[model samples]
Target chain A: MACMNEDGQWIVLMGLLTALGLFFLALIINQSALVGQTTAEGVLEFPKNDIRDLRSEIFDVYDSYGTLHAQGRLGDVEEDIIRISLERKNAVVHFGNDTPQDVSGRDLHPVTIHYNNGVTEYDEIVYY
Target chain B: MVNDSGQLYTMEGVAAGVIMLLTAYIVISTTSIYTPGDTHIPDMQLEQLGSDVLAMMDTPDREGGTSQLVGFVKNGTETCGGNDLRNEFLTNCKMRAGDEDTKLRAQVYLSYRRTDGTVNTTPLSLPDPEFTGRENAVRVTRWVQLDGILPGIPDIEHSSRPRAVLVEVLLWRA
Candidate 1:
């Protein structure tokens, strides 16, 4: 076969380059959509609200410990929290409060709360 | 007479047309993939808003006090009124930047453990007859500590003792 004129072959090369560029752009866009999906899934899975709600509930237990109708039944309430969290939420939760001590001119209990599900683990010591 | 010099330009033009169509197809298909991912964004938003509302409800208006949720749910029906709780919750959820939102509705339930080590869930509010029970509804739950003998729950202690309970709310559009 005889070779034809090669004068405008750069047009074909430029078209090839443009096609490569578009392909990469599509790849990046697809990857970005994946990133967005994972970010939303991560926020949903982290259980931030669950942990916060658990902490507040623990504080309420302490508030009701020696007063109201629950006087002298703190242990049973604590058990209630642990068992329920494990059973319903599929999370292990443990919390305890130390004796009240004077801090900043007021008595405060040092409370430690720990929570762990399969994915997220959180622990905190809060004064109340 | 047949002309041949213009054939190169014709070939390039055809090549350009093909590339443009291919590019458009690729772009459109890639963006379609994005819509499926975008669905999660709305769920994320609803879940976050539901969580924030529940947390705010659990917060006491005054320092060193039980929130309205605790007060209304206390002791399993002593001070807790289902109507009052639902009204309070709806009011909080409906607040918006513009006209008061009228589209949100909620149903409340309480879950506690029985003596047999099983959990029982009871309604804290009357079930809305209009609820269609959409799967898109977001469920937000908070922990409530009750300090009296719960009477309605089956297989639990009848003595006046403190216990932990879960307050769950299903929020959805009307």
Candidate 2:
């Protein structure tokens, strides 16, 4: 067979180059979108507000500990906290305030709080 | 006419190229990936920290005593006690396992109701000097229930009655 006239060979080469360039550009854009999405998702996933709320509630209980203990309702309140956290929030939660320890000339009680949802776990020993 | 059979192949190639370019452009533009350094996450974190600090200050460490937050609101003058509030807020917010400073600044405002039922806001703390009026500040508020009207604040007919007041804090990193 005789060789055909190759008049438009440059068009095909240009088309391939354009396609490759576009492919790379798309890849880079895809990676950038993933970066933003993961950052927002990670922030949303971490239970910051839950941990803060739990800490405040624990401190409130600590504040009222003497009165609640005198009235024998401390255990009830503690049970309520744990049960509600487990049932509603899907987190196992427990906290207890130890005897008031003198730190820097101030009586501050050492409180230990534990929290665990399926996704994240937080434990802290805060002086209230 | 060059009796061109290659014209059809060239046309096909042009169409394919146009289609691929359009697809890539649309895909890239439609995703619209925003810059990750936007204000949302930091605002959320600052607001959360401000609220946590406020709530902590409102909690009394022992029974039968008023919370420090309540006392500050009830007795604070327009210019005084802001230092204490600022110091305490910074102390609580910056306290971590390590002693690294978080470099946060806050200004407190109190919202109360007049006797004719108009809500008023009064500044309890001043914003820092570094606040150049363009910072990304977050406002966090808390409801403080008082047994009696705040003593220092004037122009309220129900000063002797129980009231619920809102304490707002504008927080930013200086």
Which candidate number maximizes DockQ? 1
- Which residue pairs collide, candidate 2? none
Pull out the clashing pairs in model 1: B72-B80
**Cα RMSD to the true fold for all candidates:** 5.7, 11.3
**Model 2 chain A weakest 10-residue run by lDDT:** A80-89
The sequence of per-residue lDDT tens digits that candidate 1 reaches over residues B1-174 is 433357678668667866776677667655545547767777777777877877887788988877877777653433356656877888876776875768777888887876666777777787888897765677788887766666644445687656778888888777
**Best-fitting candidate, measured by lDDT?**
1
Give the lDDT of residue A16 in candidate 2: 72
DockQ of 2: 0.05
- Candidate 2: what lDDT? 0.69
Interface RMSD of each: 5.8, 9.9
TM-score for chain A in each prediction? 0.84, 0.84
The list of candidate 1 runs beyond 4 A from truth reads A1-4, A7-11, A68-70, A99-108, B1-34, B61-66, B74-80, B99-101, B129-134, B150-157
lDDT of 2 by residue, B1-174 (tens): 344467678769777877777687667666646666444677777777777788888877897678888777776554446567777887888887774556677887776665443456677776577878787787776655554545576454544544545566778876
